[model samples]
Target: MIERWSRDQVLALAPDAASQKAAAGVSAPAKWLVTGVTGAVVWGECKGSGAKPYRACVDLSEPAYKCSCPSRKFPCKHALGLLLLWSADGAPPVEEPVDWVGEWLDQRRERAARQEAREKAKAEAEPTEKAEKVTDERRARQRAERVEAGLADLERWLRDQIAHGIADARRTGLRDWDELAKRLIDAQAPGVSSAVAGLSRVLRHEDWPARLLAEYGLIHLLAVGYRRSAELPADLAETIRSRVGFSTPKEAVLARPPVRDHWQVVATRDEERDRLVSRRVWLHGRATGRPALVLSFAPVGQVLDASLVLGTTLDADLAFYPGAAPLRALVAERHAPATPIQAPPHGIRVAEVPGLIADVLARDPWTESWPLILTDVVPARSGDAWHLTDHHPKEENAVPLLPSAAPPWNLAAVSGGHPVTVAAEWTPDGLRLLTTWDEYGRVVTL
Candidate 1:
């Protein structure tokens, strides 16, 4: 039996406003040469100005779209129009799809089957690769020993800095810190190395001494936690291991039980560091009301994964990495293609965000930032700095925006001094806006 999608759901797949408007224009019954629905597939040929009519088809299972149009947008106008027609019960039911639709379906099935076979073969061969597995474990143990020695050396160096006073360390210069970071990298402790490198950025601040000491305390705590990881709780030990540079395998994360939900793709941001581009996608599960972070990486100048689009809701299963605060996850299985999200699954008040971060920090002290959706917050400016203040009369909550971020003139323009829903990243520095929903419910990426 075919499960019909609503017109709103179909239109939600449009890539942009122009595509949505164009799709509506072409959705009339008279505009199509012929339209039919066979099983879960809806297909049609739309009359166009060109000699040949445009062919469009939609696979409801994956909710995939294909159109023989010049438009580069996914779910081109013709495809969206066909879906809109189908949604309105205008496309007549048929026994079979036309030649074009049948051929496309066959090709999709063949590709899916090939992928399945590859994965199956890899899974079957894993048990026979015992020698390789043993070698990997041996190398991991050797690296762990090196990391232990490096941390011990770091602890001694930290003590020496404190003993000699902050002035002496300041005079030693950034080269000394860079050499220590290099040693941590050689020890295969990239996580700690990153933390060490970040300390250099703090040197530019006004109260460098106090800030430096606080950062040093955190690093010292990480070293102590790693040393006493064996005595810690299982989850806490995993957290410590991750903070010390050990990574949980993607396959291992997927092997765990999956959390199925309508995961709303709230925001996506790309960052470049050390010639590598990293993409962070934030998801909010409707049913569970839990936030999940999906990360992808590519070299500079290369395209990152464009699968998760902003404002789309994915019916999928996500498997989380092992940790006390399990925010990072892998998409274990996608039940359907991404669709438009009407609104945020859940949102918290500006006052409640701190408590949430505190809870996460209690579980994973090394957590650098958290993703949050703020409700009824209006963008306001005080002198040169900006903040998101609660619009309600009783609540006196206000959170500062990241000082380094460009002045959100677009956001202020959208809000026009009114309350708006915003999805942002809460870092130790300040809030970094990602996406916002205006009065018309349109998504605006900051």
Candidate 2:
């Protein structure tokens, strides 16, 4: 018998508590008809609800899984259960894999070999930079035409909302919006489709009428912006194009001059969807005082790219993506890994709220959210309403907190009745805090 992992280690791979529980339930030897451990690979045949058994295999060396179960969940329950059985105190004996397992392993090896060959060919036959740019631009133009058609359709749909009363949003079915969004997806306009889906979510809210109108306005604004994009400034035009689902080439962005700064990582979040896991890291440039979001993605179980440690600063050069509000960016180069640093005495402070709004809307009206760092602000509660107020109560600075934001409990606790520099997002509704740096230079995510 061989045991490669502790029970806890095996269960840790489960995506959720439910999967962990289910894996434990099916870990008994009676549940598996055949079990074998061969080298770094574990293979098992578990009798499932169906007449035929389901095959499960895990490659311990690379920590990969392949299962015949129909469950879309990566490393499906069967894989987890097989690992649990293998990790049991009296584990399965090391034996040569059965015929079915051998076939699957062979297929995996062949696929990997083909992939290596393809990558090798690509590396050996790399296109010249000029050729690559020309190809990329041509593809971008074709995609832009499709996006334009989709935006036109979305604009017409927004106009239809005005024909009927705002209450008509309730009568509009979820599938109706989803269907149009799917069409936009087919038209390669994911940004507009995402906004359409957001509108659908808004319609379910208690204040659907007002939310619907606002979303309607946003779509109309984007449509109008798209039409007059060519007439706008170069950067603003790029911003509108990006908002309408046009992607800037990473190589092009990297080729541009990089902004060297000591960037402080403010907040970090990881979102897992289907087979992909995306990491969004927000970095605040200490020198330039600009906020940038660096995004990275990996397969479900793979390790992510270099991480951005929260509350730490890194001397790095970041390449900003072309946009009117250039928050999204890529780390082009780094002088050193991030290190802990005292909270610098600088965060962008909007002197005039209306002026900030006018500036952002002027650059890109359809921007749903923008980075906002408020200096010396405190979370406050007043007669069934919550908002952030400037340190001085007598001062004229008070902005309502968005309903969806993390309640101000943590912010209040961290503040302890004092003002703090807060990093938040400005939406159409109000401010939503992301991270806060207190007087003691301590950082907490709200």
Candidate 3:
């Protein structure tokens, strides 16, 4: 028998409170034309305003939902309602699945079988190591040639822009940069394209000329670095190539020696752009005192990997990418499931941040920011701005918070005017708080 889920458990699966409310409204037996459960599947036909009823089903084994509704949200109201009804014993047991439910189940099984076969075949395939290496080398060489040509064109364009006058460039709209950015992407240099696209943000700033000039200088340096990567240190060359859009395969990264440690997941932040979501999870090694970043991505509305929870510690082996200042890493292996933690594995004094940023920038100048866990700090408001003041009575030092950060009302509420530990991203602008530990040592998302 398939174990039944409680009403609360079913409701908790809702994407939002609105969905929960809608599901509750649709859960009554009067709203469902028919509902039945068979094996690990549940099927329901919900009455709607339309002439025909909407079909919904749930694969209880995976807790996957499907609904014939015009809703883009996952586990739409109908599906959630069906699950809720089942939880309330509204769905009676059946000897066999309805035709549509059986068809859906069969399709899922077929796809799973095909995927498994493909994976198994690839694993058992004979090795052609030497030929594969030659093919890979040829591809790498071709990509390098394309990137070099692109950088050369970019350098000429940068020179032309300066010759025409920086003021004239500023007069143009962001679309102008986007056009060139498209060309860079076509040239197989997406990293450079992203850098070019970001210039539009600089144009909006009050002191754009200086910021723009600095950005141009950095782009120029990246171009030159790639051109002369052969003369640079191995690690520095790798960093330059990476900044120019080169990527290492996951298999290769995982094959490298791993750094085993008790990794504390400090915080996670998600950013959505152009229908894509990017998640950044920050971690600190309890024993090594090293910081690492794990990034994951998914299309809008799709679920991202949520294995790394905030304020949890994992005994894992992380494989770092090749770079002068290695920070981004892959969780190559896990020794055990993550355990909850009240505070960061390690926290630094606010005053020590500048030196750490300097050290990292010296090695990877193109780095956008660094992760920081600050100890003994209280959120303070000065007129309109916010800062993190030292908790020590004798210390008169403070670090300014990022101007764009949403009001630190939550941080202030959690701190209650006392000291708290903060996890933040340290950029040139200011500190962007990510999470904090309250007076009772409870982790709170900021």
* Position 363, candidate 1: lDDT: 90
Across 353-419, the per-residue lDDT of candidate 3 in tens digits comes to 7788899999999999899888888998898899888888788778899987888999999989877
Highest TM-score, which number?
1
* Best-first order by TM-score: 1, 3, 2
Q: Lowest-lDDT window of 10 residues in candidate 2? A: 344-353
State residue 70's C-alpha deviation in candidate 3, in Å. Answer: 70
Q: What tens-digit string does per-residue lDDT give for candidate 2 at 1-446?
A: 23479988998899989888888887888999888888888988899999999999998887899888898887788899989888874345566788887898899899999999999888776766668899979997988788888888887777776875666466764767888889999889888788887777776578877777888787788778888988888998888778778788899999988999999888776789779999888788887877888899999999997667888999999999987767889989999978986864376444566687788787777866777778877888877678888787567668889876657898998889887888877787787778887667888778
Candidate 3 to truth, TM: 0.69
Q: Distance (Å) between predicted and true CA of 190, model 1?
A: 1.1
Which tens-of-lDDT digit does each residue in 290-404 have in candidate 1? Answer: 9999999999999999899888999999999998999999999999988999865569989998799899889987888999999888988899999998998787789999998
- Clash-forming residue pairs, model 3: none
lDDT for each candidate structure: 0.90, 0.81, 0.90
